[model samples]
Target: MSVFAGHRLTCIRGQRVVFRDLSFEVNAGGLLLLVGANGSGKTSLLRLMAGLLAPAAGVICWDGDDVRRDAETFRGVMRYVGHLDAVKPALTVAEHLRFWAALQIAPGSPAQPEVTTALEAFGIAHLAELPGRFLSAGQRRRLALARLLLVPARLWLLDEPRTALDTAAVARLDAAIADHRRTGGVVVLSSHAGERPPEATVLNLDDFAAAATEAWGWREAW
Candidate 1:
């Protein structure tokens, strides 16, 4: 089981600062929710945690190792799912999953059985042979999520994962997340929707409104 720790995180986008001195820790088997309004730096915070963006100040440590110092090593233990589905329109559902799975020397392969299981779990089994372009928005989202089952990483960084999912699909997503937590996997997600797994800790980005307001000067503009 691995753990992620961020201390005094500070991020800047151009002249505007997103956060300052923000810190949090998430261990394996835990879930953390990042909540905030639009343009409140929720995505920025997640990117920082995923090591896609560098913090202007402070450090992100994974299992006591500085992620910035060794990003590849840190990324090896983590999986990041952004708001956009990284699926190729030319590929079928199974092909998409297999492609991503082949890139990582991980525990599971996104072969037919596992792909079918994941698709069935998300109620997208019927779309297995369909190309990414042929699926609906919701179906594409499910296909993207199916990749998670194929690649078992200790930490998961999800940004609005429930987008475009139906009620049943949402329930399935919640169940999958719960199961991941039970298996000692860590998750940190940012979402405007109130849907969250049971017993998950909440971190409202509004708590840093003062910093955001001060950094962006929205008070004076509005």
Candidate 2:
């Protein structure tokens, strides 16, 4: 079993201490949900995990090996879905998936079937020919979520994935997450929704706020 862990992580963004001394671990088939008020370190922590930002202290390790040692390799095994949708105005829905499938899937393998499957998973198969600009907010969000199914990755880092999703779309997302976890995939997401994947471990950034205040004399509230 693989383990992804953060030990004593301290995040400082633009001279503001977001959180400090935060530690957590997720084993294979595990789910970790980050919850906190806006301005908490949830997104920051997710970005750190995705190797987009460096931790001011501590390290992120996969099976005891520091991710920084080989970030490009580490990134290949993970997928990150942030607040922004990656949709392009001119690309049709299928084209968008094909673009990503090309990058994530192996060379020579046909990507159409996988793209079709992903579109169906998020109930967007009908929109496959539609341009990204024509889709609704909910549809765009579903398309973003569908990318998860197009290729296999061990870790999924999502930042507020439920943002524009309807109840049904959210259910699809929950199901997708469940399926991923069943396959030993690790998921870390920040959400404000009442419903979440079952048996998820919670990491509330509120718990780390005090440490940041005390350690850095940061007084402005998040």
Candidate 3:
């Protein structure tokens, strides 16, 4: 099985240090639930893991190579769903899915059936013809999220993915996570309290913060 590990990660924002000396690991078929209060660096950590933001210190490694060294390869294997719903307002839902799916596939790829399945799972199959501008907040979120299944990603880095999803849609998302894990995929998702699945690892950013603070206190005392 494959492994992804972040060793002694440090995140700094402007003049403030958000977090430091944080380490976490996720194995293939494992789920990592990121739990923390607001401004606790959960989003920053996810973005860092996605290779969107560079960590001030430490390394995120997939297998053995540092992800930052080959961000493109890391990105190819990852599906990062952030808070923003990045969609084209002029494109219909199906077109959006098709366009994204094609980019991830080779030339002359067959029609993607998962696009329809994802739309159905998100309960937006009926709105597949609707433009992005016509969709409600929840619908837009679902549409953005459905793109995950359209592409094959070994690592899923989700930032508050359940936001704007209905109860039924949440259930579907959970099921999808389970299926992904069963197929030996790794998932890291951030939530306030963190809704965990079976055999999932939990990372509390507060623990890291407290540990960093405690270490600073010890150094000062000594």
Candidate 4:
């Protein structure tokens, strides 16, 4: 029963507090859906879980060990896909995946098969020989999502992953997520598109924002 948990997390950017006392937990083979309005700290929360941004207060733990203490190991077992599509205009789709695989996969493993499988999973196999510069917005997004299959990570942190994806691509993504969970992987995602994964636990950032403001006895002026 591997568990990834966050306790009483408080996120602050510069002088403003984004969310406070937020907590969540996801067990192996579980999915968490982050729901909230824009600027409600969904992205910040994902970044916090990914260790890209340290929490102002609280801890994120993996199987009862504090992630901050073994940041490298925690990072190695998780992948964070952010809002931007990280594609290089100069590299063909296959090249880009191969480059990432070289960094993520074990030295002696056959990464090419994994690369092709990932592209195929995302329905982007046909785009493998195409330069990133020529890809449409949907194609580029699929290319970014395909990285999830390139490596075996325990946890996935995705921010707005469905953006720019068509119906078919979205279906492929949902299927990929389901398969990952079946293999004891965990996923935490934010989507404004209102698409929900089956049996996902929902956490609303707006609740945290309201609670934090009331706890502090302050309100922002409009």
| Alpha-carbon shift of residue 157 in model 2 (angstroms) | 0.6
For model 1, name the residue pairs that clash: none
Summarize candidate 2's per-residue lDDT along 87-108 as a digit string, tens digits. 9999999999888877864434
Candidates in order, TM-scores: namely 0.88, 0.90, 0.88, 0.91
Ranking by lDDT: 2, 4, 3, 1
Q: Please identify model 2 stretches exceeding 4 Å from their true place.
A: 105-113, 210-222
Tens digit per residue, CA lDDT, model 4, 11-70: 987656889899999999999999998889999999999888999899999999999998
Each candidate's lDDT (Cα)? 0.80, 0.87, 0.84, 0.87
Question: What clash count does candidate 3 reach?
Answer: 0
Q: After superposition, how far is residue 57 of candidate 2 from its true place, in Å?
A: 0.7
Among residues 3 or more apart in sequence or in different chains, the pairs in candidate 4 whose N, CA or C atoms overlap within 3 Å are none
Q: Write out the backbone clash pairs for model 2.
A: none
Model 3: worst 10 consecutive residues (lDDT sum): 210-219
